[model samples]
Target: MPVSLTIIPELNLVHIIYSGQVTPKELFEETQACYQRPEYKPGMAEVSDFFQVTSFEIGYDEVHEFTSRSKSTHGGVDIGTDICLVGSTKVSEPAILMYEGMIAAKEIPIRLHVLPGYPEALAVLNLPEDSLKYFPEGCHTERHLL
Candidate 1:
């Protein structure tokens, strides 16, 4: 299936939901399409809700292309990412390492909520706990519950 992308303004983040069936380039295009919308604004961070991601590949070239394109198109906005959840089961060490490396190399700070569900992700993201009144728990996923 084609990846789904959503931008949450309150959190200043972009959420990408994808199934491994799609290529990273396809997903990239979909995300770019969303940013092309006049209503879409450059977010400070990105969250890849791989909860449904079955399988995929993202090499250095793809990463560089995506970030460079985003920076140029989004008014020089930097990109940070949260990829704590993507598959149907537990996250793999290699995947985690890859994400960690990406975040480090890109120099973009990201938050990883190892809890089983989304609530924990929000907590790790440092969203105001008391401000839960202001932000709903929609973004919380099962991965955060771990």
Candidate 2:
């Protein structure tokens, strides 16, 4: 899969790594799975790595719909942390812009941070630079899929 999601319970963080080309279906599925995790709290911070994604198949409409659908489940009232997006790929920026727009329109309680790397993501979430090691190097994403 091109899109993957990892939820870190100890850190109260969600990590999404997108490699190769991404499809809308895969993105939505992984996202839903991420939120369904027992460790996934509303106020948890997130780091999304899209630098490896060569391209994305979804457009503004799909992005908007995806976000709209996510609203009922993704946000938690106590969501105390900001959502950080780390994407270096060209496709990452436009998607970020579109999603930001959707978030603004919906007035979600989450602060979306669009960055180019995990270092900036950690900084945005006020986490230590070395904290990344705490997260699994493997596919920690699937643990939340069920």
Candidate 3:
């Protein structure tokens, strides 16, 4: 699979790693699958790492529609979620913008951040630096070590 999801119910966080080429359908389906998981809850935080994604074919409409339709079975429409996106590439900017625009329209508590990588994301999310261990090597900076 191009996208993998790891839900940490203890911290109310979700970790996502996406690689290879991803399609809009696949992305939506993967997210829906995660939302259906037992650990998913309202106001859960998410760190979506797209650092490994090589390429993708998506447009604003697709992203907007997908996000607008997100209503987790357990987490109702008003539920909030904090999202951090990891990646800094020319190709990633559009995705970030689309997400921001769509999410803003929802007026829910979903907050989004774009970080260079996992190290910065941890700080932004206020997670213990040691939590970086959950990610693979190179996901964190030496300063992220604690």
Candidate 4:
């Protein structure tokens, strides 16, 4: 299956769901399409679920380009990844490298989060599961006073 990217501005997050069948090139293309919306500016933060990815790595050039573009177009970027059994074991290493690359190239801060799963990712975003009362299977249904 092709990778899919979902951006939820209201939640201030971007979610990338990959099926492990696509190449990084395809993934980046899809990501660009998702962010091409006029309303999407630079500085958007995102969370990625690579649970379905069989194996992957971000090359140095790719990392530099991504971080540079994000910083120049957006204010900064945060990338969160699932650290469960199916995700990246070298998550922290890449995250730090990407962050440093971004800082050095564009002076942008790229934040990284290594989460166990969706619930943990949401928790890191402060959108805990307890916040909702009746959301769908993976959504928060709790009511909040906005």
Candidate 5:
């Protein structure tokens, strides 16, 4: 799989890394699975890394679909949190922007930040640059799929 999710309960953070080419289905599945995990708390900050991603097989329709699914599954509650999107190259920027736009349009109350790299993500979250050292080593899996 090209996508993985890592949840760091200690930091109240979740890191999602997308590599190669990613599809909406894979992303949705991993995200839904993350929600089911004991470590996943509402309003946890997220770092979504697309640095290794070559492309995203997503579009307006997919964004709409995912947004709907997310709202329904999460019960339309305020899951308000900070989300940092990293490494948005030309190939993946559109998808990232579309999702951010959708979230705004729906009044989701999330604070979304689009940055060039993880260092910026850390800074935005007020975490130390070396904080990544706390992430579980080899925690990448489709299920805790980082």
Candidate 6:
């Protein structure tokens, strides 16, 4: 799979890492599957890392539709969650901006941040500085990866 999901329940964080060439179907399917996992919580913060993604095949319609469905699953009158996007200018900026636009248009109350890498994402989420020091290489058993 080009996409992998890692949920760190203790930190109320979920990291979705994408690599190689990715399609809209693969991306959304992995995300929806992640939502169905037992470890997923409604308000948990998300770090969507598109750093290694060489190509992201998505567009306005796909993002809009996903955001619409996502609103039903993650929107309400309560406090919203944070979503940090780890991406690069060439590969993922357009899609990130589109998703941001959708969220804003729908007024879903999700705080989205676009950062360069994992360190920045950790800072935005207010997590420990060293939280992902050994990530994607060596991780604790507590982190459930799918």
User: On residues 31-144, what C-alpha lDDT tens digit does candidate 3 reach at each position?
Assistant: 888877877875678888887888767788887767776533323636566689988577667777877877777664576888877767788889887777676565665553
Which ten residues in a row are the worst by lDDT in model 3? 70-79
Candidate 4 local Cα displacement, residue 32, angstroms: 1.6
Q: Is candidate 2 or candidate 4 better by TM-score?
A: 2
Model 4 root mean square deviation, Cα atoms: 6.3
Task: Work out the TM-score per prediction.
Answer: 0.59, 0.84, 0.84, 0.63, 0.85, 0.87
Choose 1 or 2, whichever is better by lDDT. 2
Off by over 4 Å in 3: 71-79, 138-146
Best by TM-score: 6
Residue runs of model 2 more than 4 Å from their true location after superposition: 75-81, 135-146
Kindly list the per-residue Cα lDDT of model 2 for residues 2-27, writing each as its tens digit: 97777887788777788888888898
Question: Which regions of candidate 1 deviate over 4 angstroms?
Answer: 10-12, 70-75, 78-96, 108-116, 126-146
Report the lDDT of model 6 for residue 8: 85
Give a tens-digit lDDT track for model 1, residues 21-60.
5566786789778778665765445555555555556665
Candidate 5 lDDT at 112 equals 86
Mark the 10 consecutive residues where model 4 has the least summed lDDT.
79-88
Each candidate's lDDT (Cα)? 0.54, 0.73, 0.74, 0.54, 0.78, 0.80
lDDT of 3 at 93: 70
Is 1 or 6 the stronger prediction by TM-score? 6
Which portions of model 6 show Cα errors greater than 4 Å? Answer: 138-146
lDDT of 4 by residue, 1-146 (tens): 55766666666556666655545587578877877876554555566665556544566677676666555555433542221111444533464455455655665554556554555555666775553332234433222322
- Greater-lDDT candidate between 1 and 5: 5
- Lowest-sum lDDT 10-residue window in model 6: 137-146
Worst 10 residues of 1 by lDDT: 131-140
